[model samples]
Target: MKVNIRKWNGVAIWSWDVPKEEVCGICRASFDTTCSSCKFPGDQCPLVLGVCTHRFHTHCIEKWLEVETSKNLCPMCRQWFQEKTDDGDGGTGAHANTNVHSSDVVSTT
Candidate 1:
């Protein structure tokens, strides 16, 4: 599956859709923990990517953020970051971006 990464002139700038696989990032809970939540298999878990690009579930990343305050990096990458603030009241767990840059895209993989 692919969609045009459009340009200003309505031209397709880029096109990509990598096949998602069973990322071992998510902790194999006893059962499906992604219940009452939103996620898929291929799209990386934003949390794991925080430490590294190796994908995992959002919940998994949140847990890491809560536990490891000094470990500000993707579990796979060891990159440090300037953590952002919660965009809004994101429930018990706040939300923030990893500040990852476009140049860092390749390293995450």
Candidate 2:
């Protein structure tokens, strides 16, 4: 049997490697979804994993850190929030602005 095709379409789907039941510590939204401040998911609302091992939506954590009372602490563990770096050095500091993205994250899955 022989087959010939002239037209073709392809669809692809992608998702964060986080567990389905896990939610952002700050926004309480799943890692696969955007935070309340974001209109859509993906880079616009990337997930940030803190040195304390708590995860939050980028916008959520950014907003929280901006508040004077937040004291740059992880909303979940109350530890100083720092963007876990690639070197596994814990991170620089809460205000370091690591600019990390989900795609750049080392998969913990």
Candidate 3:
């Protein structure tokens, strides 16, 4: 009898409270995984969504927003990315409830 085992270990898995399959529109990277430019996911490279219901890696969107051609619009939907308030209470006005997924509603953290 011969027994062979390559490797065995517990791997952590993470999921986002998104209706569609969790994937960053900008980098197309899974929400549980880091973008190509990032070495790791989570706080280091968190996921952020725009008012248009489009999602992307925080770093990825931040960089994209810096581009002169972006005009503060979402890449997928071209909707204005409503800026959040200073206290993170989201923005005021029409897009205040733009957030599709609420942490209080469905969060693993």
Candidate 4:
């Protein structure tokens, strides 16, 4: 099922929270431009894509997906996170939470 802006917005509103932005993956610089639709924090994790293509401030994904029982993945690519892994292990990083199946959540796209 596709989760439209209204739905995500409602969810965020029901929870009394807002989207996060500003913060780079490597340099910790404030993010000024990011596609809210396809870019998110996990997208900015130093553990992801190596070089950041997003500007989610690191808090957006952290606040939304970070949980003890929950494993956070890139909402955009649905790929596992990793800073720099060479031992393989599915290419997951040291801080990677776990694999998140795209079939599990409402599609934001």
Candidate 5:
């Protein structure tokens, strides 16, 4: 028997490494999906992992932190919000301060 192929279509799927049920604390959107403020998912709307072990969309957290009442605190645990960084010791250095303040963010509209 002989077979002849003319054309083929390929598709690929990708998802974040976080658990399927996990969602952004600020927007309550799944890790694989974009937050309410963004139009698309993936790198353009990246996720931020807090020192408190909570994750949120970068835009959501940035907007949240810009509020005077937020006080740069994590929405999930009420702890000071800071980005978790690798300390070169294989352990997370959660104490690194992001120093994000309301004044630091400029309002476009």
Candidate 6:
């Protein structure tokens, strides 16, 4: 009696629903990490996506919005950066333009 053996090959792919491939526009730092002002990245400085689909670090975007020049506009699209409402869960939820009056807004993650 004789037996034969076969080898199997497989591939796995991973992805995230982020708006960009890398880095926050405002701070120019990788999405996987936090901005300069933050002592740590990750959960402490998670990424935030604007209604315009522009991406930035959470801390970075907050600082940018606080500036008088920003006027609550997305740096990339110049669209009114609608604020996101917390889902009550740990993650962020849909976009709510409670301040502005634009119909082109999209939900953020």
TM-score of every prediction relative to native: 0.34, 0.75, 0.60, 0.26, 0.75, 0.59
Worst 10 residues of 6 by lDDT: 89-98
Which model is ahead, 1 or 2, in terms of lDDT?
2
Compare candidates 4 and 6 on lDDT and give the better one: 6
Give lDDT tens digits, candidate 5, residues 1-109. Answer: 9989899999989888899999988888898989887788998899888778898899999999999999998988899888887767464764466457898999889
Segments of candidate 6 deviating more than 4 angstroms: 1-20, 84-95, 98-109
Q: In candidate 3, what are the lDDT values of residues 4-83, reduced to their tens digit?
A: 98998989876666655668888887887888888976778877755555678888899889999999888888888754
Q: How big is the positional error of residue 103 in model 3, measured in Å on the Cα after superposition?
A: 33
Candidate 3, number of clashes = 0
Off by over 4 Å in 2: 88-109
Deviation from truth (RMSD, Å), model 1? 16.1
Write model 4 residue lDDT over 1-109, tens digit each, in one string. 9865754333322211223453444344444443243254333432223212332334445553566443654454544433344346654444443557979779779
* Candidate 3 residue pairs in backbone clash: none
Model 2: per-residue Cα lDDT over 1-109, one tens digit each: 9999999999978888788999997778888888889888887888888877777888899999999999988888888888775564445445455577888989778
Give the residue spans of candidate 1 off by over 4 A.
Answer: 1-18, 22-52, 81-109
Clashes of each: 6, 0, 0, 5, 0, 0
lDDT of each: 0.44, 0.82, 0.74, 0.42, 0.86, 0.72
The residue pairs that clash in candidate 6, if any, are none
- Report the CA-based lDDT of candidate 4 relative to the real structure: 0.42
**Candidate 6, residue 2: how far the Cα is off, in Å:** 30
Q: What is the lDDT of residue 6 in candidate 3?
A: 94
Winner on TM-score between 2 and 4 is 2
Name the candidate, 3 or 4, with the larger TM-score value: 3
lDDT of model number 3 = 0.74
Model 5's TM-score against the true structure = 0.75
